[model samples]
Target chain A: MRLSLLSDLNEERAARRAAVLVTEVGSGEQRLVREGQVGSDPLAKDLEDSLRQGKSRLAEQDGLQFFLTVQTPPVRVVVIGAVHISQALAPMAKGIDLDVTIIDPRTAFATPERFPDVPVLAEWPDTALPDVGIDPYTAVVALTHDPKIDDPALMAALRSKCFYIGALGSRKTHERRVQRLMASGFTEADLARIHAPIGLDIGAVSPAEIALSILAEIIASLRNERRRSA
Target chain B: MRSTDTDILKAAEAWRREGRGVAIATVVETWGSAPRPVGSHLVIDEDTNFLGSVSGGCVEGAVITEALDVIADGKPRMIEFGVADETAWQVGLSCGGRIKIYVERVD
Candidate 1:
């Protein structure tokens, strides 16, 4: 058993309370699993359940016992429009450990200089998102006011099981966007999944305040909040 | 070691050095619908105070009570779950499977 994996079982020393440990099974390719107090990785939970039923093999992963404690790791964030909001949003998002990625076909906006720690993609949404795999744990936010850059991503999020989707625009712009989406094939249910005119009714003015509101909404969504629509 | 793991271990080891009783609870085995994997744990002090979780909140009270008793006796135990135990899920372990917990007290 790898010594790192034994850390899970060892931490429970006699009277010490147990903590959950989640380790990625593979090193080369990323296969992240959240099995502890805060890891809601659906597949990880499934695998843990399967093993708990008389299959003790999971107890010996790579010759190590593998669960750990209650810390919720970072969530993945995909920003489709690399606009001013993202310039402000990425840093704040990183503060909470959400691995932020800004995608834009415009080379000028999508540069490492603009986004130091974050990964920038000078590619369009259709190509970028598939590589990212907008999983259930992924939160997608669209900040571009332009339809050509934002539309494809909104469509992709609608089709996937992403945890959160937010788009920036004025009410009128959103209304028009809705019409266009309806014409293109989105149902009321699909449209309902978006938080266009995004962010809570926080009355945010500056880009930073707006970013905070957006993050708040994402947190609320992660907690599965339901709000009555106007 | 990962910072999170190190932080938790430091807490555990400190308690042990203080001459306070400690027991490590490990999810040694799990099946069907267990919420935690085979290595999940819930550390418990002699007072039944805890630092981690194995089955959400389910089985915790029992584990705590057992933990206190283990502290008193200095005996280690392996508590099994799932096959037949409503008490474990009373607070909420409806994973519908079993878990084997190796609860060991550090001397």
Candidate 2:
């Protein structure tokens, strides 16, 4: 690997862009392919599959062997609350390599002291999320349980290609939220994307347990092949 | 804090920029219960200082030894380790897995 290529790869990662370092095994010849440049590469199909899955692998073309070092943007979790659950979720998510950011319009809750390790935005999700740059690699979780805060975040997530979107609520509460979103022109299909009653049903009662369940569900949504396509 | 892949590569580039001889060892292939996945990196400077893991510390000593030679010669080498190899007793994976690592100089 060349210094310039390594620097380019790091730049793409910092900018949250995907890239692949393709190296010929025998000759040590290498090239860095950015996300949009894959279409013109000789290993287009393999590169596309590797990027989509965020996995690296060895590929054989003709008689030569190549290693594809697939580098996807780091997975980010955007929580639209600085509540107890978010406090627990932030550190736990970071332990597993998920970059977490907390957003809450209430300055009282979104204090740096509350979330010392994670980024906390004392602004509404509509404003904060745009600067945060939600993309397919991001997971949005609304844990405020307040319509004023959670609803706007959900709306923003619904409009983006975020991989996971969940809102903390009871089933009845979700029904009301769904009706409101439907009234705002989101179809049932769009509403279906939100994992209301958020988290896997593990009978979680405590905030920490709830955070564990939510993280598990997010991992499932990320690694499951079927959900990746959906 | 654990070094992520990005940090490992960045450190490699930084080490080279600072006029240190650097090499990167990557797990290009794995079989069975490999401790680390393919594309996992272990960046080593000429002094044998390393960051990251290609086998969760299983075969790092041997990889670093080989990396020093790669950095000196500027030639890439692919090395394999497994229980099946004769060096298994010396530096093979304790997890009973086989891995192919590619060590190359940061030219």
Whole-model lDDT values for every prediction: 0.68, 0.93
> Residue by residue across A1-230, what tens digits does model 1's lDDT show?
12233344454422233233443222211122333432454335535443232122232354544433332324578998777888898989877656788999999889899888889999999999998778766789998788999999999999998889998999899999889999999998999889979998899999888989999899888755322210
Looking at model 2, the pairs that clash are none
Candidates 1 onward: DockQ, in order: 0.08, 0.73
Q: Candidate 1, DockQ to 2 decimals?
A: 0.08
Against the hidden true structure, what lDDT does model 1 obtain? 0.68
lDDT of 2 by residue, B1-107 (tens): 45688878888888999999999999999999999988999999988888999987879999999999999999999999999998866985789999999999998
Q: Which ranges in model 1 have alpha carbons more than 4 Å from their true place?
A: A1-73, A225-230, B1-107
Q: Interface RMSD for every prediction, one decimal?
A: 10.1, 1.3
- Candidate 1 lDDT over residue span B1-107, tens digit each: 21233344456666777767877676666778877765455777786667767776678777788778777776666677674676654645676777777665655
- Using TM-score as the measure, the top candidate is 2
Best by DockQ: 2
